[model samples]
Target: MHLQKDTNPALNTVTAYGDDYIEINKTRHQRSIYFTPEGQIYDLGIQSPFDFTTELLQKITGVCAAAKSPMDFLDHAAPRFENPEQIEVLLIGTGKTQQLLPPELLHELLNARVGVEVMDSQAAARTYNILMSEGRRVVAALII
Candidate 1:
């Protein structure tokens, strides 16, 4: 969506861009945000009384956000194979470029023993789709 100057002062103009796969927008909060098929943005002022960023990641990964202590979003995105010996990788999208994740969260994931890789949102989505089509249970979070 293109950002246009609104005549109504109450309405803020949000600029959005994307193709068939994903969309990124400059929200009213002035933060560049990403969207998922679940119809939820990464940070869009949802009141849940919890860390919404963490919760969104869990939801996108199809894991029970309440199950574990802040379930590893990456691991949830890329689920474990039926055979424990099989290795899985999670592709996390942080936007136009790979952004740093919360250090504490990263440490937690590493401690839980899951393979994690961070990439830009577009690349992450593409890679995830490729892996899944190849009969891999990989998950991706596209920011935008």
Candidate 2:
């Protein structure tokens, strides 16, 4: 809500977003940072949001050229959890433009038992924060 640090430093929060930089937890980073409700933050490389995970954040590819479609990217990284089906929704931040997802992409997510929403990076960040604050099972794949 506020462009400031979290009341509790133990949690990771997005402080502000600039043209090509994002300030998270009071630290300005030009690179993307993957964070979870659990408050752990990791530097996300140039790879798409698919490569970042709550437990392990790794850059599997340089720029994800193999992903001809968004669905390919979405299915690229499936998190390791007790039950992957527990994740209710996935928020995808598509850089500066609002992305219109294809039916196949939606079908893929539905098949995975997860809902999907696509928005601009800023909205994605805000929504991800708010939903995460509410203790929802959410993951943000932000294209910063």
TM-score of each: 0.44, 0.62
lDDT agreement with native, every candidate? 0.45, 0.59
Candidate 2 residues lying further than 4 Å off, grouped into runs, are 42-85
Residue by residue across 5-106, what tens digits does model 2's lDDT show? 544576667778865776667777676655565545665564454443433311211111122554655778643223332666677676767765555434
TM-score of the candidate numbered 1? 0.44
The most accurate candidate by lDDT is 2
lDDT of 1 by residue, 1-144 (tens): 343333222322123334323432344333334333224445434322123254454443443322343566746654331323232555676666677676554443343344557776556656654564465545444444
Q: What is the lDDT of residue 105 in candidate 1?
A: 48
Candidate that scores best on TM-score: 2
> Backbone clashes in each candidate structure, one number apiece?
3, 0
